[model samples]
Target: MKQGIHPENYRLVVFKDMSNGDAFLCRSTVNSKETIKWEDGNEYPLIKLEISNTSHPFFTGKNVLVDTAGRIDKFKRKYAKK
Candidate 1:
């Protein structure tokens, strides 16, 4: 391995804020925000996420609808023409 030629690897926490609940886990991601404290007396940047495995409908054995790119309506419109 070479020195000064590789990106820095640091420890950070990932927080998921889902409709059902919230969770925290250790991960390596890029962030430029200030530090934040956790209940375990550890401090890291506060990263807020919308979904994770805990609350994802597929993982939780429930049905869900995710329409982020308007694909649902696009498919409907295209299929309805035939």
Candidate 2:
């Protein structure tokens, strides 16, 4: 265990999975301008996540494809042959 090496701004933050609307509260130093009322009736910093263990394919044991900003479509269009 090391002292003064860890972040001093660790606070309870809400991590939400946007794909499935799943959220959990945990300590984090990540900054967020958004806030969410948690189940415990407390307001915490909101951190929106594209993929988390709740909705990730590997963690959930379900194969799923996540497309961000239409990257998959862009790639397909770029490689599609006439």
Candidate 3:
């Protein structure tokens, strides 16, 4: 263990906003422009996520098309050989 040579480790919150819902949980990640109000009415570093366990189809047991933009089709058309 070294002092003054390692990055700061602090408690932070990760917020997930997805098609299923939104949730907040504690994590340790870096963020430059995210903030969240804690239970004690204090602001802390926050990370915004698009997909998480709650919204993931595999975890929810729901068959869903996660991609709304035709990205899969575009990829196939571009890479798949005729």
lDDT of each: 0.70, 0.91, 0.69
Which residues of candidate 2, in runs, are more than 4 Å off?
none
Q: Name the better of 2 and 3 by TM-score.
A: 2
Give the residue spans of candidate 3 off by over 4 A: 1-8, 38-40, 68-82
lDDT comparison, 1 vs 2, better candidate: 2
Residue-level lDDT of model 2, residues 5-69, one tens digit each, is 98898899999999889999999999999999999998999999998998888998888887756
- How are the candidates ranked when ordered by lDDT, highest leading? 2, 1, 3
Residues 1-82 of candidate 1 have per-residue lDDT tens digits of: 7789856776777574545447576766677475667778888777666667767788879788655467899999999989
* TM-score of every model versus the real structure: 0.56, 0.88, 0.58
- Number of clashing residue pairs in every model? 0, 0, 0
The residue pairs found clashing in candidate 1 are none
- Winner by lDDT between candidate 3 and candidate 1: 1
Instruction: Record all residue pairs in model 2 with backbone atoms less than 3 Å apart, i.e. clashing.
Output: none
Rank ordering of all candidates by TM-score, starting from the highest: 2, 3, 1
Q: What C-alpha lDDT, on a 0 to 100 scale, does residue 62 get in candidate 1?
A: 76
The segments of candidate 1 whose C-alpha lies over 4 angstroms from its true place after superposition are 1-6, 32-34, 65-82
| lDDT of prediction 3 | 0.69
